[model samples]
Target: MNAGFDVAVVGSGIVGLGAALAAHRRGLRVVVIERGSEASGASVRNFGHLCFTPQAGLARDFALTSRELWLGLALDAGVWLRESGTLVAARRDDEFAVLRDLAATRGVEVELLTAAEAEARMPLAPGTAVGGAFLPRDLQANPRQAVAALAAHLEREGVEFRRRTTVGAVRPGRVETSRGPIDVGRVIVAVNHDIDLLYPEVAERHGIVRCSLDMMRVAAELRMPLAAPLLTGWSLVRYGAFSATPAAAALRERLHSERPDLAALDLNQMYTRLPDGTLIVGDTHSRGATVAPFQAEFAFESMLDETRVLFGVDALRVVERWQGVYASGPDDFLIEEVEPGVHLASATTGIGMTTGLGLAEHVVAAFSDDVTTTADEPGFASAPTTTLQKGAS
Candidate 1:
């Protein structure tokens, strides 16, 4: 029972794994305890689109830090990553206005593309795009592979993983798991939406709840391969940076008035093509204390209809479909030390893959004196003792 670990992380998702990696790099003995046999949560059930360029405030800070960590993982851990910047296809002038406003603010980070240029870059139906913008700094990864590879790489670096072990309680210096008691210097809870189960008070205080989304993979014949992760006007109104633009209000109002059905679904219509050429399409949002297990078929049909209209393709063979759930809150993240020696870290939105690593690193660095932050790693500074407040990434 006495594992002699310096840090014990709960959950094996990206944030948990990132915590273990950060602690291990600081020469601390780390143990990860997961209730599942493997990581089968939101970590793997996402688009793997590192759309950090559209983030604002603290989320943007974490995103910049995550970019470096992701690039390092690609070289060190062999996690497959691409520098494929995000491509936003604007179907309406209002959407283009939002992108243009963002481009004005971000300069080189946001590159405005003409209608012809946008069509040339992506396999969109010719002339479908009035204009668009390319986020040159954003990246992409295979969600199915990145977390597993990172976990495996951590295991090779002397971190121990206790899979199928349920953690019942955590206190100042001890964690009570189903296996037994573990003595550790620190405890990090990164269980995403399940934090409610472990620490109801913390979840309640932050207004944390589950946000479920439906996503699918399909094999489709395109005019050409998807050059990068694609975002539609729906996406422009969802991400923080774009939504904060003055032009976003008109865009949102117009879209909602035009397509009440899609707006009813709370869609963030986006797509990312996997390395094998299968396109990952998603998704629709529904938030509650607990989401329904049943997914509506109409959601899938709507996605298919949108996909066909966007790409001008007739048929798409369905490969798979599933639901992805993540922590949702009023603010962008939930980083707190609810009790002495016990910390909570979670991305309270869909950008966990984009910002989770940096969030984890920031939390660990806050309390651990051994964590070294180089000059190049900006925004890795220790978090304030107060709660972090910002909009969604």
Candidate 2:
């Protein structure tokens, strides 16, 4: 107990922090080792939107569950969450129908609106198109703030985080970091592409890779209208670029037929209003193994063009340009005991906000050798409350 840690987790990203929290809650002596000063990876990058809808199957469930946990954290840790609801504007009739179907699904409640109806609610400047579905449960937060707060909370729980420290080797019941060698009952690798950096054998056990793409944040508006996030038909079409299912394929075809301009633009994007009126828009492309470090300016521009065509916006001030790196390893959640004392987990399909907590719980249960005490609440665990107050992280 005085010598090393019960579990050593590599990577200080969202997943790593979630894992540390889960392990700590289960009463395991946990330590987190990060290669960055803060969460200097994809965890803190991109729009800090904890997406609520347009999610299906497992990711949707995990997202809902993570949101529940976030509510508790907001109450306890004072993490900020803007409770503005999401609106899916249906420029065309078919799109409106699709949203209707989405709402019809059990456990999903969506509010429909007409052009006049939506304008009154959203205050869209009269010509902001028409027809949309409003779901009030969607929420957004500052990713950096949330991560920092989580790190602090874990520290208070005696969970140690060694920022800028690298793991040299992973052996069963121990981890060798640049800081020093520490023995442990279990080791968890939460790093995405660089996971192999600590344990080369992890490459054979699990595919570790990066996802490169463009992200844009302008300095126009300083405040967001509502606390929720936004996505458009561009997303449904682009979802096909990543998935090959029949529904996805049909959706792609529909997008091509109804909105050929979107297909031509190569734009699969989701947009959210920043707190100040500037917008946060993104993203496309999912590289399975190794994502490149290039920004497709044309793709970004196309996203803007699609933005104009969809929302009919003339222009907004452009300030920030960004790139996001993500990890994915099929539908399977990653967790591998590489050797006697080494464990590996990464490539989580860009669902960090959704599945991180569930994954955390799973990791904790496994690490404790099946000793567990986590039960799901009736509805969602986290609900939209007041604006989250800014705290330490």
Candidate 3:
């Protein structure tokens, strides 16, 4: 079956969908091939926190571009999106220092809050925060709703979706699938961690691994509704903008020394309240070539305990528990040209929700002659192909 298309996206995940959207916008015949009937991957399993303010370097550039696309989706695709900026509660002096330092560098983008102000804005325990910061540029979406809505919107926009079809291989101008091979002008591989399965050499060359996360949703009574997606000191050490601060080193030391157990779990204590008011609490990271299906109960318990302490709640009714995985690599992204006319794209860290769309847009624009490059657009001047090399220090 030669259903010729100008572009073929190899996954229905956020990045893949973004590629399809970009190609479709350029008047290219686009087809999305998915192994499952729907998107059921890290795209849905995340906190839906679009923390764009904390990104640095190339990730920050992509985040800025993605922000515009996301806002457009809200108006065009009817995707549920909130302009609610990210809130960071700093319980300790070191945590406050990290926020303070970032504020100094970022100026209006990072607004520091007093203890009282922090408590009033965020649903933290009355006096749990010594200080905090609000990142006005961030956003929140319902992970369960966003991707599905985006997929639906793309389908309505004349993009062809071939769901329940497994992609066996991708060559220069063809995508071999479970159903049959399709002729494509270009191929965009955005399968996240599954890149290892489809293109083992590319995955290995980029030092890609699976980073599994433990997360849960619970119904809980709060001091007040969370003003936005909330981050804790545990988060300060993870994000590029916060972690790169001079004060972050001391903060990291204090956190690890105080709670080795949480450190061992690789915690990024954060919360996002869904529209239904259930709280999404997570998460802990563990990375390897392969992740264990058995999630440790202790990791969940630790998260629950931290949540109870942070919110000053005694009880929480557990709604769901699950594991989410993404592609983890040494760099912030994996953009490569495995072969001519076939591009590989993946957010190597947990920033896919923040940067995936822009990454896909840039990748597609690199090959599309119709797409014009703009001076203001970040990462659009040149294709990011072959940037991540194997064993490059």
The TM-score leader among the candidates is 1
Residue 327 in candidate 2, Cα distance off native in Å: 0.9
**Tens digits of per-residue lDDT for model 1, 209-261:** 99999999999999999989999999999988999898999999999999999
For candidate 2, lDDT tens digit of each residue in 1-393?
226777888888777887787677667788888877888777777677665565555455555667776776776666776776676666555556566666666677678888777655553445664576777776777776888887887788688878887777777766777777877777778886676566556554555566666778754322225335665655544321223223444555777887565465445567766656667777765564556676756777777766555554566556677777776545435555667556565535665664566555555555465343446522123212222121110
lDDT (CA) for every model shown? 0.90, 0.63, 0.88
Question: Over 4 Å off in model 3, which ranges?
Answer: 106-108, 373-393
Off by over 4 Å in 2: 123-130, 196-208, 220-227, 237-249, 257-266, 286-288, 340-342, 369-393
Ranking by lDDT: 1, 3, 2
Model 3, residue 153: distance off in Å is 1.0
204 Cα displacement, candidate 2 (Å): 6.6
Could you estimate the TM-score for every candidate?
0.96, 0.82, 0.94
Error of 2 at 220 (Å): 4.1
Candidate 3 residue pairs that clash: none
Candidate 1 lDDT score relative to the true structure: 0.90
lDDT of 3 by residue, 25-72 (tens): 778999999999998998999999999899877787777878888887
Q: CA lDDT of 137 in candidate 2?
A: 78
Ranking by TM-score: 1, 3, 2
Candidate that beats the other on TM-score, 1 or 2, i.e. the better one? 1
In TM-score terms, candidate 2 sits at 0.82
